[model samples]
Target: MKQPTTDISSQQAEQLLQPINQFLQCRTPASWIEQAKQPQSLPILLKDHMVCELKAAQSAMLLIRRYAVDEDSGNALLQWLKPYEDFTYRLKGNWRDLADHNKLNKRMVPKSTKPYSQELIDKMVLLIKEELHHFYQVLEIAAELGVSYDRITSSRYARGLFTHVRTYEPAALVDKLICGAYIEARSCERFAAIAPHLAPNLGQFYFSLLRSEARHYQDYLSLAQQISDTDINPRVQFFAEAERALIESPDSDFKFHSGAPV
Candidate 1:
């Protein structure tokens, strides 16, 4: 079960972030922190963050759709995401209207879990719900901050991690889950690293996100371990190194998960 988000003190934040910090290969680089906290950066920050929340929801949906769910369940999942996609992609919907569409209209019935387990569906379904909720919260904050939503190009961080995934069955899924773990872990690290520098409410909002995202990291790791037929230590190490390089190296792009600014 997941823990609820509540007000957390600096000391509590430190305690919450301890495991995430250790799991990540390195801290958010000082350069990135400086860049992120600038007055002009908030819109871009919220814009990209809003986009990312939607993307995270999409990713989790696709995971269960491809590997776990039946046709009706998969279609329902797509419908759940449609409003946000329309707002972002087609610019055809109101943000306020999106709140009405953030739930699964019907039950998500899983199909045969051959390459994966029921836990994958269980964890990912919860993840999809939370990520979509976060998407809505980001829209609320962006609206309050007077930041309008616009599409932005994705950073190399996720694609760079995916480039190394094995093409084989179960291994591919396992690798993807490991990648998910690292992504969630890095998000927790970055939110902790940057929250204090944001506006009070925004900082608190970011802190509130830490609990769920940390659980997401753990869930992804657990699913990866469950799916792997072999000991996943070496594979986990492999992605850890890959993830470290992505976090620590310099990059020209600046997204939430981008490397140090070049």
Candidate 2:
């Protein structure tokens, strides 16, 4: 995988992915990459990818809304996502309307009481911005390639990880952030693994995503560590095992993060 040459050198790409490669338990199986590049899978891939971008943004927004922002800011965040939600859920809006709604008003007042959680406001807010922008970019890519965005189901990857989330407090938040790290790390891995096999433009797009997704993994990990009162190493290891199982086990649903195809 030495391409994405226009954006960065292969040596740089390898260096960029080194931490992500070290973090994850396995490489994406060649079969999965082959599956992803199939012509029949392209529309499904683009549609689900578009949804994933929105979902990523939504999760980041939820973190800021529930744990960091003032109520008004939370409401503002909701409105920011409404157009996207409407399109995904109700099929009510067009892609053209989405861009106008991506920006959050400068009213994200931090809560004085939850000083620690306030840290989430900045990182998660940046994630929200970039992810929503990604959602738009994916929509454009899909349209350009004549792929129609439609209703698509999720793979078991995220649900499987979330099942391990603790039924408790900051611990739960820590677990969620850990899960976020794995998800981001895996996305980064898959993007690199499959990029070389895609059309040049799409390959470049996926390649361009590598740095941000890698940074997202690190950000999620740092947040998990920062928010945890106790050592998060054991928990991180625990989730790593869980994520590994999800990635290596047999799976029928094939989406961006699905494991082995049945």
Give each model's clash number: 0, 0
Error of 2 at 131 (Å): 0.8
Q: Choose the strongest candidate by lDDT.
A: 1
The C-alpha stretches of model 1 lying farther than 4 A from their native spots are: 1-5, 113-116
Cα deviation of 41 in candidate 2 (Å)? 1.1
**Tens digit per residue, CA lDDT, model 1, 224-249:** 88878898888888998999899889
In model 2, which runs have C-alpha deviations exceeding 4 angstroms? 1-6
- List model 2 lDDT by residue over 138-167, tens digit each: 888887777877788887888999999998
Q: Cα lDDT of model 1 overall?
A: 0.85
Candidate 2: RMSD over Cα atoms? 2.6
